[model samples]
Target: MAHFTLKQLKYFVCVVESQSIAEASRQLHISQPSISVAIKGLEDVFNQQLLVRHHAQGVSISANGRRVYERAKELLRLSNELEQDSREEDELVAGTISIGCFESAAPLYMPRLVAGFKRLCPGVSIQLHDGEQHELMHGLHRGRFDLAFLYDLELESTIVKEALNAPHKPYALLPADHHLARQPFVTLAQLAREPMILLDAVPSKSYFVDIFTQAGLSPTIAYSSPSIEMVRCMVGQGLGFSVLVTRPRTSVTYDGQQLVQLDILDDMPDSALIMAYLRNNQPTRATRLFMDYCRTVELAAVTPLAASA
Candidate 1:
């Protein structure tokens, strides 16, 4: 029988995932020698050369190492579940949950959600990361995040999603003084003729472009940005109009410029915000509680965004 501790497996997994003992050491806040010893101990127990170490370049997992790494991840997940179950038996939930959120939606939703969840489960801590859709999805697959909050856009078959809110129609953003600012509603055909400031983030850029293509129109993208606020600031400066679903409470930009929101007259697909997790990865007790909290909470009501147009 192989006698090894979970700590050894954890260290080994971290080194494999990070691809460097030094990098894993930094992440785990342990010394490089200590991590190396843990890896060596695991290798000795299994009698397998699980890693191919390179001088200063990092390390690569051997074929056998790859298989072991997968099993290690599963074991760690199961161990976490078992620990959570034991903690729950005491009627006190305590653990940390890592969450990934869409960058644009994070500012609007995460603050309130995190605060409320923490109040309910004071024993549980949260670590949140916000990025683009691809980044968030990558985090989910890599096991960096237990779950993610993002739009239900081109998700993989392995991802299971729960809708957090009804689909929201996208609105056009324009400078307050623009010609079409006073219009109660606008059409894609009209906006198609004007310069467009595209939100260039992955999935978002493609989604907006698809919307125009579906309408048999192509926007003249005069400028593009990955940051939502930067896109809004450009619109406020009369650079170009933008299409967006996440609306802030105020019509002003960071530079004190005012913007206008107009409903799109054309029938377009609505966007749905969702909480997604991997189908294979079971949620810990704390993660399950947070997921439940998300389902019951009125996220839109707590956000500072204006009512949908």
Candidate 2:
């Protein structure tokens, strides 16, 4: 008979996912020796070498460990579901939901979304991870994130997405004093000829570049950055113009320089913000409630700073 606690399985999963006992310890707030003993106990019970320890580097799962890890994850998930199921009759929903958000959209929406959701389910805890589209998708596959808030771009078919809001149109951004700033709207041809500050994050880079390519034009890239704020700051400095989907409430950059938002004269495909998750993995009760809350919120509301094209 296998006698092991869920805590042991949790510690083992954390070590494998984090790839470092030290890291798992920090995340779980447990001591290294305790985690080591837990893993050793599991190894002893099974009479197998589960991990290949590389001194000072990290541990890698052996063949048996890989199988055990998958089962452990499923078991942990079932355990969580069982707990939630038992509390279904209660008015208070309590559990943790891990979410991954796109870096560009996190600042604009996460703070409000998280806060609002907490008000409805005060007993629930939320964990947020913000990164590029690729990173978020990877986190989903690895079971690190229960849900992901990101743009509907270049996603695999296995990812199930629920549209969170109406499609958002991409618009041109420029310094307040740029040559084209006086115009109410700008065309791709007009902007293509000028220096472009590209938002170089994955899927975003290809999406922006494709916008010009589809119109038989190519932007003259003067600067490219993964950070949206950095791209905005460069535009504010009049280094180049940029096209972005999400608009901050203020038109001012972090450096306090002003920017002008202009409509795109040409019709383009709109970007939709979506709640994504793995199709095979069912969302927890708390996650489903948060998802429902997200659907009711005005997630697509942006300041009407730009004029009609």
Candidate 3:
């Protein structure tokens, strides 16, 4: 049996990411021949080909290579976490904590989270990455993110999630003086007839549509956008109304038209926000501290609606 080093695994993952041994070598400041030797050593140890080489065109990962790549990333992360967690409690909490957040939630909460956690643990630093739910989950699994803030929707079995204190329910966004603006809450059936400005982000789009479907109502979608501001702008223009989970602190849209928010009275599915990490990995000390900080902070109070610029 061939013995593989952590260095080999690291080199292998870089090769897969960079798509070629030459690129990985350049990025890592290692020689191309050295990376090739490491890769050959890995292939020998695994008894399977990890990459397919082409003379002019770059290499491609084999199916098994993809699996190994994911596991290798996880192993590297676990190793790093172990080193961080092993530090003395009295020692300063110092290290970079990589976080992935849902795009919709990032604008609302990242600054507060970073600032608050840094305040409590001055030695710690935070790195933030924003993506849709699926993208965030993928990064978490790939070990690109140490932790993530995501919605409790369409999550994979391997993703372990801790729900935040508040469960965000669907709410209506309408032009300030619309006929239904006086109502405290509007039902799906009530809004079914109105043109809808759909927030077209993944899982969000499906989840919102399901709420209408469950209510035996179908909304007439007038516009769709991945951007929350676009949806808000559409609503402000009176082109349609939108259903949103995160209410911006600002009641005004980008165009400066005032908008109104109404609760959804119908029994609709609410999306719970969560702090997620890979199921099998152990949390580092810094990760634990940040998670603790996040748990104590209430998102609503920290992230009030702001004037849309």
Candidate 4:
């Protein structure tokens, strides 16, 4: 069967709102019998009773009728909205862009970036998704995201990468009393004999380990945790120590325990954070607008600092 006509739904709404066929006919600019015939035709197609008539009281909608009326109104509203949205998108006044986010980037980088983008591009819509490095990269590869932030992205031959922030140098997290804590910076050789807490979820752990290997120091992993918070908490308690490249200032603590930021004396890690996009995939205007904004606000050149540990 053909879909119900928009006219039928409009006529139904009028009848329901007026609660009388004669009034509906007057408002709809049609005869009462014509309205009655359309209503009867709809009820027949639905195979359910809708309006019931009483002598002087006009018509009252049944339960099923009320449900259909509500749905029809929603459909009509949505249809109008769809037309308006199409018009805006065609004019580049409104559109949607999806972005992929890495764990560290979203926490420290994206909050301000998004707010700024919205101010410049008020008509565009942004969709945000947060995930680990590999997960975010996968989304970018699959075209699931228009733009993405990934860390230490060892690129294939076809991807584009741009430096977004300063290279985050890894530092040894140690208690204030530890002998290594006295130095302005710590080297891999200095902490080689000590136990270390490794954060499994950190994408840069392997790179940091490689930095140690090149320096001829083998770290002994005394504890392992998947959560960054657990790693910080363990480091604070002096259970063990770890090397972190990118950490929020809020996580750096000068309170409970005396901690030192020992700069790695070994060869620094090569993985620098970057904003990447597929080389072959042409970006939409909205995507380009957002990318430009990240580059703009980032002109202040935010540098990573070591506060405590």
Off by more than 4 A, model 4: 1-93, 251-259, 299-309
Ranking by TM-score: 2, 1, 3, 4
Model 3 ranges off by over 4 Å: 1-11, 14-50, 53-59, 63-71, 301-309
**Which structure is stronger by lDDT: 1 or 4?**
1
For TM-score, the strongest prediction is 2
RMSD of 1: 2.8
lDDT of prediction 2: 0.90
Candidate 3 local Cα displacement, residue 142, angstroms: 1.8
**Tens-digit lDDT string for candidate 4 (71-152):** 8766654554464456665574456677887764575677778888888878877778888777777666655566777765
Clashing pairs in 1: none
* Candidate order by decreasing lDDT: 2, 1, 3, 4
Q: What is the TM-score of each predicted model, taking all chains together?
A: 0.92, 0.96, 0.82, 0.63
Residue 293 of model 2 has an lDDT of 93
Encode model 1's per-residue lDDT on 1-309: one tens digit a residue. Answer: 879889998898888878999999998899999999988988999899999999989999999999888888889888888877898768988877989999988898888889999999999989999999999998888777899999988899899899896337788999888888778889999999999999998788999988999999989999999999999999989999999988777887999888888889999887888999999897899999999988887755323333224
Encode model 2's per-residue lDDT on 1-309: one tens digit a residue: 878889999999999989999999999999999999999999988898889899999999999999999899899888888887789887668888999999998988999999999998898899998999988998898788999999988889998899877447899999988889998799999999999999998889999988999999989999999999999999999899999988887788889788888889998887888998899999989899999999999876566454223
Model 4 poorest ten-residue lDDT run: 298-307
Model 2 CA deviation exceeding 4 Å by range: 304-309
- How much is 148 displaced in model 3, in angstroms? 1.8
